[model samples]
Target: MGSEKDVLVAAAVFLFALISHSEGIVGGREAAAHSRPYMASIQVPEGENMKHECGGFVIADQWVMTAVHCMPTGPNGRKVVLGVHSLSEAEETKQTFDILELHNHPDFRESNYDNDIALIKLDRPYTTSVAIRPVEFMRQGGTNPGNDAEVETAGWGSLDNLGSRPDKLQEVTVDVVISALCRRSDYFGSKFTANMICAQRVCPQPCDQLYKKQDTCDGDSGGPLLFNGTVVGITSNGGRKCGQLKKPGIYTIISHYTRWIDGILGLQPDPTPEHSD
Candidate 1:
């Protein structure tokens, strides 16, 4: 029992780390309400209070996709809240559901966050509305949203490095960084795999002029990285600081894991392996 408790505690911390950023959003702005309808908040009980651990996205009526690292180890109260902009106040658009099941990828590596994707089965199907829509996934054979492409990311993560959780959701525009450049960074150093993609917050000015880093922090983990309004990546990991120079945020490329996801969703998995650009 003691060992089991220890494991649970460790798992809790890992989940927290995966979702919570000590250094918060570096260059993010408050998002408009209902602008990101597919956003889902994964919440877990922490003593007397419930905390948002990670961000996810609705894919189907009853399915959510998130990082495998955010999976709860023990049943200490877990649920997903959708269609809400504010975490503190109740809104008519808000819909909460208990998690019926969690399916982590079979090859997910905890040590390195390889294959860091998972599917969440909600207890009931969510009613579709303008404020509660599912996000489209990158289709098979779709062109990769290449390096330097601007993408949108949203979450209710911390506002700064001191760890101040936000009441309202925030958003930032980031650019996809070349994989080779990302792999060469001092922090990641060849750890990137085929399943991973790297992105960096768009600099306010060109690097040659002025550099202002923007990125997703702790609470943004498992959130969708949107390209052309479709989910291209899921937040995985980043540097110790939220927005460090050259330390691009890592994400689980959705296209690479479509087979695993399709298997869980009862859809046909594509036989051909996706090629990265």
Candidate 2:
């Protein structure tokens, strides 16, 4: 609370970046049936029905990784659907569970969209199958993604900004842009932080302006950004619209919070030396 203008600016930023209500997966193709076993559809209780709110991915036996902005605070009955392809069809491969705990990053700042990661513990461990499994995520000491690395993100979000939520899963690949470019005065600028990764769906060589763009949106929040079969980031937020070249999709770098995740998962390393002197 510095000044009245400052407060207004902060509120505007929060509203503009509050994309949890947008649909997702612009300029993407429908994924194959049961192809993405680790994909999770986060649902919240709406009236008497559960509504799809965000996307997530299974990281461990009972842990689902997503963005903090995707989860609801307090002890609510949240549902997760895994190993699903079509939302309209009742597939035999789908696995459902209730969330047991919500672990949002303690440093998360909604006003600035910082540290937007979260880990949700399910009521029970998922049953392993060919169509249901966990995805590996970047841990501490892991290498950062290379410049222009192609990453994949999928969800049942909208196909455009018109709020058309898809009934099936959709996927798109975007190139990782350098932080320096995203931090430019015209781009995200100072609002971009080191803990964030910016990715954009580039047009192919000799492409046209209307060639169609790709990106994550609305219901896609909290989904996995996979590079080389491992999740390196979580879908955080973006600009006013989806699939815009200037407004690249931003993600929460997972490696930066591996220690916190380990503690929550009960995998923290022992402080004592392995061998006594």
Candidate 3:
């Protein structure tokens, strides 16, 4: 995961995904088939058909991670749809599972959106395939890509602020906005915190920072924010309107809850060294 080739690959993604000229996607493009095998769609039952509610990503064969707000309220529980690129297509590799259990961070609060993370235990393990696998989490001790570094986020989020959802998965490249800037009164203000991160599409040459750009909107909540080929954050929320000027997409920083996540996964903590007399 620390290889130089991985960095080059990430660099390549941003190099070709230059700033967009169109208002496309709030500004994004359709992703390639099976390009992101770890992507999952959180869907709730609507009569005979399942309705897409939010996005998630597989962290392990049987565990999926998402925003705490994405958890269903009633007993009906949401389903985890993996290995899919389009919500409407019945692809051969697509796999769906009823959630066996859900673990939301105990301190999570919808009001301030702090500690807004959750994990889903699938009824069964995901089928490993060219179209199904887990996304990489930043290993312990890994560092963030830092401010203004290009990162990629994908989802079937609304194509516009008016609630236009799409069938095909979409992806966009954005730059990490330093927290201090996002914490300004004009931005998220007191609502922003260290545990949260903000990112937005970079404007093309000569454009201002607030220039309209691509961003995740409704139905994109609980999705992943990948930096350097690993999961580093989860889509939490945005402003009253999607792609609103100055409201960069806010995310729950994954590293802040790694211990809780690892504990829930039953993983052992790193051993401490013994002292000699």
Pick the lDDT winner. Answer: 2
* lDDT of candidate 2 over 190-268, digit per residue (tens): 7888889999886778998656688888899999899998999999888889887788999988887877788899997
How many pairs collide in each candidate, listed in order?
Answer: 5, 2, 1
Per residue, candidate 3 scores C-alpha lDDT tens digits across 1-277 of 5689989998887866663333334688788889999999999989888989999999986999999988735226668899999899789988999989899888887777888889999998877999888999764466877999888889988888778888888888888888998999999888998888899875678987556677888888899999989988899998878776689899888876767788889987534421111
Indicate the worst ten consecutive residues by lDDT in candidate 1. 18-27
Candidate 1 local lDDT, 156-245, one digit each (tens): 887766687888888888898888887774758767877788888655543644344788888789999999888999998988878787
Alpha-carbon deviation at 60 in model 3, angstroms: 0.8
